[model samples]
Target: MSDVRKPWLPPRWFIRLAWSVHRGLYRFSGGRVGLWRPKPGKWGAMRLTTSGRRTGQPRSVILGYLEDGPNLVTMAMNGWGDGEPAWWLNLLAHPDASVQLAGGSHPVRARAAVDTERDRLWQRWREIDKDLDAYAALRSSPTAVVVLEPRAGQG
Candidate 1:
């Protein structure tokens, strides 16, 4: 008999360590390494800087994103960990933020996708990551799909 194999994730500490290492690379490189633009049919990495919900200080992190029309879509999964990512939490208290793309940086406003918007963006993510649902299943709550809309002067 054949059996289904569930998705596997590294230990929580390992996941956290990996994130720290990645952020370290970006910081140590002086903005020279890391971050990329999302290409057609693929997700890309970028640096998202948001204001701390409590401190009002700037907090930055690397994230994967997909381009949808003029907006950017990213997930609020903390490496599929139990709680929502702190960056997402910061966004909730302060939706205004900025993203640094491979090409350039821009001001943006963030919001959680809802209803049909969430459905469509989630599907697009699934297209890029065939294991999308599998990894998300590792978490306790639904991963939020975040939309980064350009400011008034931008697209």
Candidate 2:
């Protein structure tokens, strides 16, 4: 059997330190956060908004995303313990969400890839970060590969 405990969220001090670093970098880059890219060909930070599954309130998160063809795919990187991140759960319940890409902000529909599609998408994700293979091994539940498609009139 594998450990299934929830992954520890970053400590408050760590979060504060990271925020300070990000802010300083943003200022140095003339308000652009491009300096924080984890890997080449990957967008730095994306502002994604999804409706709360139960509360119906709007929630936004700054997440790393990769463009796959005309769609954008984001991994639920809550370590290998947490099955899926809360933002992903919200998007799953309400596919109508919004995202801010490199160019601009726009609404999009979210869908969790299934089966072979999921495998292919995961492979692309691995290409971006080889370390993700470790996380992939720890997951007993399906890791969601979320696809964000541009909404009509916003292509």
- On a 0 to 100 scale, what is the lDDT of residue 44 in model 1? 91
TM-score of candidate 1 to 2 decimals: 0.91
Over 4 Å off, model 2: 1-31, 34-43, 153-155
Q: Residue 3's C-alpha lDDT in candidate 2?
A: 50
lDDT against true structure, model 2: 0.72
Name the top lDDT candidate: 1
**TM-scores of the candidates in the order shown:** 0.91, 0.72
List model 1 lDDT by residue over 1-155, tens digit each.
02324578899899889888988998899878888887777889989999999999999999999998899999999988789999999999999999998888989999999999999999999898878888888778999999999996631
Q: What is the C-alpha RMSD of each candidate to the true structure, in Å?
A: 3.0, 4.9
RMSD of 2: 4.9
Once model 2 is optimally superposed onto the true structure by TM-score, how far is the C-alpha of residue 104 displaced, in angstroms? 0.6
